[model samples]
Target: MREIRQPGAYSYVYGKYEEPIATVKPGETVAIYTKDAFTDQISKETDRPSQIMSNPNPQTGPIYIEGAEPGDTLVARIIEIEPTRDYAVSALIPNFGGLSNTNITRTLNEPIPEKVWIYKLEDGVLTNNKRLSFPWRPFLGTIGTAPALEAISSITPYDHGGNMDVPDVKPGNTIYLPVRVPGAYFFTGDVHGGQGQGELCGVALEISAKVTIQFDLIKNKSINWPRIESDTEYMVVGSARPMEDAARIAYAELIVWLEELGWDKWEAYQALTQIGELYVGNMVDPNYSLVAKIDKKYALID
Candidate 1:
């Protein structure tokens, strides 16, 4: 397996022009070492976000997928996600988060107070050594293929799937991403030890991760957005403003996916109304994200 180590092989933006740090053939599996969202700057609990952190969510690569081309589908099957460190950080950053007064949503109220919390890895759980404890629910917070014409910031999520922060992007899940440029310049970072729906407070248990992934290509197949398949469910993700729009985009794509599975458009739409489930990714990024999902049993019905 090819390995891409972070700090050296990383980018803050997803762009077609960025040089790829490594290249691998289809069906090849690779191991990636990634930094936390703060890039290891907030290691200690006393460290402050404004005092130590500069850039956010540094992505692990522009990995060139051999022979990948526009309109093709890049298949990434996440086999494992292991935290390489013994701790994780959760913080409340001022001017960021869902309920806070942010740069975009101006208000008379003051921004939320900034504070930091650290979780120690012990007995397979992240614990505060007191009352709070969370299981090791690891997932990739930022993972995407580069866009063809735009040098988009890694902080935002869009068609090519940047930092969607969906908790469902975990091990044993295979995510399907769109390919808009040759080689597919793939990137991944922002591993979280655990995160809740919507990533409500704009942060999770941020930690470094060693992620093993298998890559393959679906030739000439194009998807409007990112999709995921697990043993029991299929999900589609959408990133946009006005939370409802995100929901619409996600379900719309899921409806199309159902149609491809032999269901009629109207029938798929009608079925989704009763069987569909929704998951919130992040509410803090430039564009909020939402997911529409369906169980495999109903999706593959005869």
Candidate 2:
């Protein structure tokens, strides 16, 4: 398995122009060492977001896949995510979060004070030390390939996929991304020890992790957005400005996937209206992300 380190190989943007840090062949598994969402700068409870004025989501690579080409689909199977640190940290940043006064949602109220919380891993669970313990549910918060045309920040999510922050991007799941450039430059990082549905605070239990993923190519398969497949469900992700727009995009893409599977367009829409479920990935990023999914058992029915 190939290894990509975080220190010198990380990137802050996703674009076809970014140089590839490493190269891997289709079907080869690679292990990436990723820093926390805080860019590995916050370790103790006393350390605040102010330390890093701009906490960029540093991505781990633009790994060039040997035969990936435009119009193909890149398949990434997450095999494992193991935290490399004993402690994780989260912060209440001044101008971030779903409820706080953000740049887009200006309000007269004062901004929330920057406060940090540190959680330590005891056994397989992370605890705040005072109370509240949950099992380690590590996942890659940002994972995607380069866009065909322009450069997008690591903080934004789009068809090329960036910091979607979805909790379902964990082990045992496969993410299918569109390939718009040669070699399909892939990058991933922002490992969260665990995150809730909306990631309300805009910060999760961030921790350094070693993530192992196997890469493959689906020749000539073109997809408008990213698709995720778990053992029991098929999910499609969409990111946009307004939350409702994000939902529409996700559902529409899911319907498109169903149409490809032989379901009539109208029938697929109706079926999804009744049985589809939505997963909120991120609400505070440059673009909010939402996922529309349906159980495989129900979707496969005639």
lDDT scores in order: 0.92, 0.90
Candidate 1 stretches greater than 4 Å from native: 7-9
True-structure lDDT of candidate 2: 0.90
TM-score of every model versus the real structure: 0.98, 0.97
Writing each residue's lDDT as its tens digit, candidate 1 over 127-203 gives 97668799999999999999989889989999999999998899999999999999999999999999999998898
Tens digit per residue, CA lDDT, model 2, 1-302: 77878547467899888778788899899898888877888877788777764647888888899999999999999999988889988889988999899989999889999999888887888998656687889888999999999989998999899999999999999999999999999999999989898889899888989999999999999999999999999999999989999999999999999988889999999999999999899999989999999999988887
Q: List the lowest-lDDT window of 10 residues for candidate 2.
A: 1-10
Best by TM-score: 1
Assess candidate 2 and give its TM-score to the true structure: 0.97
